[model samples]
Target chain A: MRLQFILSEIGIGLRRNLSMTISVILVTFVSLTFVGAAILTQGQIQKFKGEWYDKVEITVYLCPRDSTVPSCADGEATQEHINQIEQVLESPEVSPEIREVMFESKDDAWVAFERNFSDRWWFTEMSVDDMNASFRIKLTDPEEYQVINEVLTGRAGVEEVRDQREIYEPLFDVLTKATLVASGLAGVMLLAAVLLITTTIRLSALSRRRETGIMRLVGASTLFIQLPFMLEGAIAATVGALLACVALWGGVHYLVEGWLGQNMDWIPYVTTGDVLMVAPWLIIVAILLAAISSIVTLSRYTKV
Target chain B: MIRFDNVTKVYARGARPALNDLTVEIERGEFVFLVGASGSGKSTFLRLTLREEKATSGRVLVAGQDLTALSNWKVPAMRRKIGAVFQDFRLLPNKTVFENVAFALQVIGKPKHHILTTVPETLDMVGLAGKEKRRPHELSGGEQQRVAIARAFVNRPDILLCDEPTGNLDPTTSLGIMRLLDRINRTGTTVVMATHDDEIVDQMRKRVIELQTGELVRDQSRGVYGSSR
Candidate 1:
């Protein structure tokens, strides 16, 4: 009847069955850790996609000035060919698709290449005249890059078209699949945890059969007899969830971000700040998982 | 008052009935001793009054409610009006003596103030006021049984069904318990004790019902414990 009395009984029940209580907590913590890992990994993948998608451009490298191809027969990109490409980019139909465009001359391309590969010997072999100038186009729709590529390629001065999305797709695919695998494993573990929790509660009930029988004989309601067992499970689950959130937070912050940040700075936005941003969600998920499993197990097994 | 009309109870998958075509009546404030050896339907009769086991083919009425027609959910409410003492004492071992007696009132959702007053009063009534802090295991056999009596009488139930309340005590201790039951009976609580202590039954000279092989052989007021002595 009193909240304090009920809670005290729950505490006693948990203490009396310490091993089973710890088992429930550990099971919940492990399952929720997997769940938290899956969620964080999915968030990281999304963050990478958003940052890379924003900076990614369609780079159309033109024929070289000293080439022997039909596009470069004039020994350089002709003014008339440049005018035609600019006209197509400025057109109302194409303007809506192309958000912004920038041109790189041969000298600019050589300078960029030199800056990128300054430590390598390959860059010393290429002169300014050997470099191919290109137009970098930022598209309005990342998914519609194929339409822009079709319109640009085979034009007078364009030699090749490349979309960066195709280059990094396999990596994102693997991360996404890893998320699915984690979630599948978590689902199975959670189900097992529920069954184990139920068994634990049933065992607790059996151990205190005399107390329960006495309670029933004295006119204690079924709910009154059952609440302590339910509280036992819920408390264990909640403790487990709390443990999981801490474990996941440390795993993401100290291990993944700490090790990976030092090795890979080229990839932007893979930071602990982002992981901490979703830490509250992990805690909520842990508590919810514990609460749900507790309710389900107690309702089924501890019916006084 | 309690009444059983041709009450018959056959346990699951059992050919013979535990109580066969039995009829009995107990008036309010009456002290009745149900005497029989083991498996003689003494326990079955007490269980039927508490609605723990139902009669198979007859009507059982306790305090004006038909045990057969009452829903399972209403059994607890019905039991609240009756007190039961078990042979094992059934005191919650983890609880202190005070808590064990207080639990009887607490379970029924009695107000905190009422419990604060009534638990001590009931403990005092059972002569267990000074030992309220001790657990059941710390007490002697008779003392533990006294605590159970306190728990039973705490709510002031209209009827008390005790299945071998003195089964575990020595004869001298058994007489003390019998005197306590008699004191409770004088307060208008119908006391039904199922026991085989021939000495107390003969000494009290109360109404006795004898059963043999699940059949009532004798029913008499002021009956001796057994016919032999």
Candidate 2:
């Protein structure tokens, strides 16, 4: 029976402050959407790392016929130079770091170069004689690129050692920084949501001061008097969270999955499942925001 | 029953004490009037019994529990045993008469069946039986006070505290309110009323405790408003 009274009180309070309640809902919705976006962006970064990191390779380029480097001053790499390089790769000192090495001859490099730039206007300016043969070395751990670089640098016929991860680092760095920016925005918006909820509850409590005074005089417990106001905030925040979840789901399903996935098939994108995974946390955060603000406001405003 | 032992209430720093170092006691089932001019501390006295204000130097005990020593969490339980009526009637303006009265029992978690039965009975006793559906604004001043009275007595409290319950009513309405209070007191509930109405005080001829500028000046059984002074 008391629960019925409290529930009815909550309804009355919401109705009495409908505009303020709507504002709270909108503020919470916008804030939690930012929170969901930040979480999903982090998830997207993890997906990218998982998909790309294992396939990265380190390439060791051999000197070309016209090379000017001191290590390659002996002119185009000889068969002996190639043999010595293969022996070093298979040596016990470096074999553990190297998963497998495929040697690409100048002809093979020329073919790949043609296939890549065939559509460009400068295609005819490059030829097989200008192409440098290279060893494509896959590592057991992509992070162990430095060990191979240290062993191969300045070696006979070796012109340059390049880790593929370096090429991808700037892309990943941009993404990670984007996630940080989103999280920073989310933090500011959440603070605004908390303050709006606090003010809404304070106004509600103040408007009903006469009723609250009577309730106090009639022996209503502090919790009993404050529950209706607290529930008012919780209900608004919960609705906002629900709206945020819907917005996130639509964004991930249509924008990320449908548009970005179809256009950029090679890049993995966050799915609706990721949005679902973050939904509960969003709702929990909303409730926690309401609960904390209500506790702070009610403590000062609803004292018997 | 209520007891005050050298109770003093100081509301602010460097201001006159609201209630001076004074002592008084009223036994169970007694109907007493606390009569004083404004600022004589009549409301403070009621507040002390309700545990709304902490006495600076002394103790207040109601229904055998030391209010000063009671923990904050236990105050609601202490107040539940006491019914209070105010000068403004203090009914929820939006709630119907029946809802206003039923609210008291509902807040205390009374069973639905008990509320369904007791609310109408209490309304009848306050002469607001058929007017249960009316809101506070829809009622006359006396009817509104009756609703307040019904809400106070619905839970069958051990003591009823009134702070100018008839202050806003005409003489005839005030008399009706006093008669209702007398009827509730006749049911063996202790009654403490604070009022400045001389005619009601003289007519009721109950025990009167008079305060003059925070000092207890008189206490008399079967007394008129200023007969003891």
Candidate 3:
């Protein structure tokens, strides 16, 4: 009987404050959508790192006959300098650090360059002798690029040492910054949600002061009187969270999986399963927000 | 049973106490009236019994429990043993007469079958048997007061406290309310009512306690409203 009464009271309160309740729902939905997007963006960044980082190689470029680098002042690399560099790579001390090594002569480099730029007019000006031979070394740990670069750079025949990770750093930085922006917006929206929920509960409680006063006189406990109001906020917030989940699911399905996945098949995108994983947390946060706001407001308004 | 041991209630920092060193007691099944002018501490006396306000210096006891010593969490349990009615007939505007009466039982965690059975019977006792579906605004002023009374008494409380329950009713309606109260009192529920109505006080011929400027000035058995100084 008490449960039935409380449910009825919640229904009455929501109906009476329809506009305010809808505002709470929309605010919660928008804020939690940002939160969900932030989580998925972080997951996408991690997925990219997992897939790309392992293939990253450190390239040690040797000087050519026409090179202007100070280390190449003697002109094109001698056979002895090439033999010394190869010995260092095969040394027992560096063997564990090097996963695989490949030597690309200028002839081999010219063939790759031609294959890539053959359609461009610039291809007519390039020749085999103008290409620089390089040693490409794959490291057991790509993060150990600094150690390999220090070992190979400033050598007699070397021009420069470059890690492939530098090529991808700017892309990752943009993604990380995007995640931060999403979280910042989510934080501000959540604050608005809390305040709106507090006001909604306060107004509902004020409008029903007479009924609550009567409830108090008849010996209703403070919890009994406040439960319906708290549940009102909780119900609205839960609906908002569910709407957020639906929005996230739709975005991931249509935008990420349907469109982007088809065009960029190499990149791993966050799936609907990820949105489902975040759904429960959004509901929990909504309930907690409503609980906290109700507790603070009810203590002042429904002081039984 | 209720006892006021030299209870004094001061509302503000420097204002006069609402109830000044007042001492009174009413035993089981007795009907008592508290009559006074607007600032005579009549409502304050009822509020003290309800523990709505703490006494400034002395203690107020209801059903043998020291209200001053009762913790905040235990106030609700303490209140369940008492019924209260107000001048405004504080009913939920959206609920029917039956729902208004059943609310009291529902709040106290009564079972569904128990509420369904007891609410109609209590409504019948208040002469609102066939008017269960009517809203408070749809009913007459007297009928609204009856719904309030039915809500108060439905829990079978040990004591009933009223603060000018008939103040808003006409003389005829007020007479009907008083007779209903009288009938309730005959059921062995201790009733303490505060009122400014002179005719009902004299007509009922019950024990009357009158206050003047926060001090108890008179207590008489089978008293008339004007007989007290």
Clash counts per candidate, in order, are 0, 0, 0
Residue-level error in angstroms, candidate 1, position A214: 1.5
TM-scores, each model vs. reference: 0.82, 0.93, 0.92
- Tell me, by DockQ, which candidate is best: 3
**Per-residue C-alpha lDDT of model 2 across residues B1-229, encoded as one tens digit per residue:** 8999998889998799999997999999999999989999999999999998889989898999999999988888889999999888888888899999988888777899999999999999989879989999999999998998899999899999999998999999899999999999999999999998999999999999999888899999999897544
Model 3 scores what on Cα lDDT?
A: 0.92
Residue-level lDDT tens digits of model 1 in A1-304: 4676678778888988899889888888888888877888888788888899889998887877666666555666766777888898898878898888999888898888888987997767877888888888898888889887878777888777889888889988998999999999889878877777777778888887787788778777778778778778877877887788788768866777777766786675445565566566655665565467657665655443
State the fnat of model 2. 0.59
lDDT tens per residue, model 1, B1-50: 99999988899767788889889999999999999889999999998998
Q: Candidate 2: which stretches are off by over 4 Å?
A: A68-70, A83-100, A106-131, B227-229
Give candidate 1 regions above 4 Å deviation.
A65-124, A145-158, A256-302, B3-8, B13-15, B20-25, B53-60, B66-75, B107-113, B133-138, B209-229
Q: Give the CAPRI class of candidate 1.
A: acceptable
Report the error of model 1 at residue B37, Å. 4.5
Q: List each candidate's DockQ score.
A: 0.49, 0.68, 0.73
Which numbered prediction scores highest in TM-score against the true structure?
2
> In model 1, what lDDT does residue B33 have?
93
